[model samples]
Target: MRSDLQIQQDVQDELQWDAILKAAEIGVSVKNGIVTLSGTVDSYSKKIAAEEAVKRVKDVRAVAVDLAVVFPGTIDHKSDSSLASVALDALKWTSFVPEERIHLQVDNGNITLEGELEWQYQRDAAFNAVKNLQGVRSVINKLRIKPGPSAHIIKDNIWKALTRDANIEAKNIIVETRDRTIVLKGKVRSWSERSDVERAVWSTPGVLAVQDELTVSL
Candidate 1:
């Protein structure tokens, strides 16, 4: 196991290495493998990048983002309607996003997505569509995955995916499907393995939600 100070430095270095993040403006602190990022960034996307960088760093068990978005006066002075229009257009242009299904609203430059998507990646793509808009202060993804049937099949497929991934030890994990939701209960060696397990399950079609209850054994 690595010390807290070592994890702190690794997270800081990762922030600096990520091209999108202005590392100098971000503060990093670590305690018991949990990294806390506190500072200010020019854009919401930059703030997200900083947090994601910390999450990817080795030995990081969790991330607490306390960073604030500090937009300059000249950022995007457009009306909220114009911002919404621009974001809607961007979503339409993105091939992966189901432009017709997901509905969005912009209030004070905060985008709120509401609707159902077929897959988690599609819902994520909907948010990414307008994540970097000039006036976007933040995004609230209220979109829910469309519920589909066959709990038995979902359970079996998720189990197979977990066993297929070499990084995850399938024997220790339990897969339970109730309706369209997947409830994962088990212990993993690290935070990364838990994430990988959840990602694998989400890739299975007809999955509505993932309830990850996996504990870190390390």
Candidate 2:
């Protein structure tokens, strides 16, 4: 196991390595295996980038992001209405996002997405549609996934996908379903494999939610 100080140093280095983030504007701290990132970035995308960078580091068990988005004065500030229009337009252009089913609200550069969609990917698409807008400070995804298919079918499909993916060790994993929700339990060798397992579960047609109980043994 890596020491907290070592984890902190690795997270800071990872942040510096990510081209999207200004490393000097971010503060990194670690407690046990949890990494907390604080400071400010110019865009919500950068904030997310910093978190991803930290997650890529070894021995990191969790991340708490406290970064704020502060746009520089050089850029023209957009009114809430203008930002809403642009966000809506972006959603309309995104083929995967059902703009009609999703509703958007912008308040002080914070975008909120609320509504319902049939698949987890569609809900994710709606958030991606507005996350990088010029004045967006943060995105709040309140979009719910509409339940689809039966629990048994959903669980079976997830198991098939997990077993088929060479990156995941399906035998070590257990799949349970509560309605449209997938409950994953077991262990994986690394965070990447854990993510792969979760991704596979989300891609199943009827999954509305996932309870990821897998632990990283490495």
Candidate 3:
């Protein structure tokens, strides 16, 4: 296992290497295996980029983001009505999102979405549509999956999907589903592979949440 200092160094290096975020705007700290990111960014997208960069580093067990979004005064802040109008327009143009069913709520700079979609990807698509908008400070995605199939069927489908994935050692994985939540318990050779397993689970039609208890054995 890598020491906390090395892990902190790696995270700092990762922040610098990522082109989307200005490394100087964000701060990094590590304790045990957890990384905490602090500072302020002009946009919510940059905040997300910072967190993703931290996860890409090896030996990072978890991430805590203490970053705040403080846009510059030169950029005129949009009214809540303006934000909602723009968000609706963006969703209308996004092919994956069913804009007709989704509702957008904006307060100050925070965004809240509520509705039901057929797939997780569609919900994600809706979120991606507005997250990078000019005045968005934060996003609270409460979009849900419309009932399509049974939970037992979802569990079986997930098992098959896990087995079909070339990157995952399917035999070492155990999958359990309760309603829309999936509980994954297993071991994988690398962190990338473990993430792959969860990604596959998310791609499935009925998965609302994933409890990843996968250990990196390498």
Report the lDDT of model 3 for residue 178.
78
What lDDT tens digits, residue by residue, belong to model 1 across residues 10-39? 887898899888888898888888788998
Better of 1 and 2 by TM-score: 2
Instruction: Sort by TM-score, best first.
Output: 2, 3, 1
Backbone clashes, each candidate: 0, 0, 0
**Predictions in order: lDDT:** 0.86, 0.89, 0.89
Q: In candidate 1, residue 191 scores what lDDT? A: 71
Of 1 and 2, which scores higher on lDDT?
2
How does candidate 2 score on lDDT? 0.89
TM-score of each: 0.91, 0.94, 0.93
Ranked by lDDT, the better of candidates 1 and 3 is 3
What is the Cα root-mean-square deviation between model 2 and the actual structure?
A: 1.5
The segments of candidate 2 whose C-alpha lies over 4 angstroms from its true place after superposition are none
Cα deviation in Å at residue 144, candidate 1? 1.9
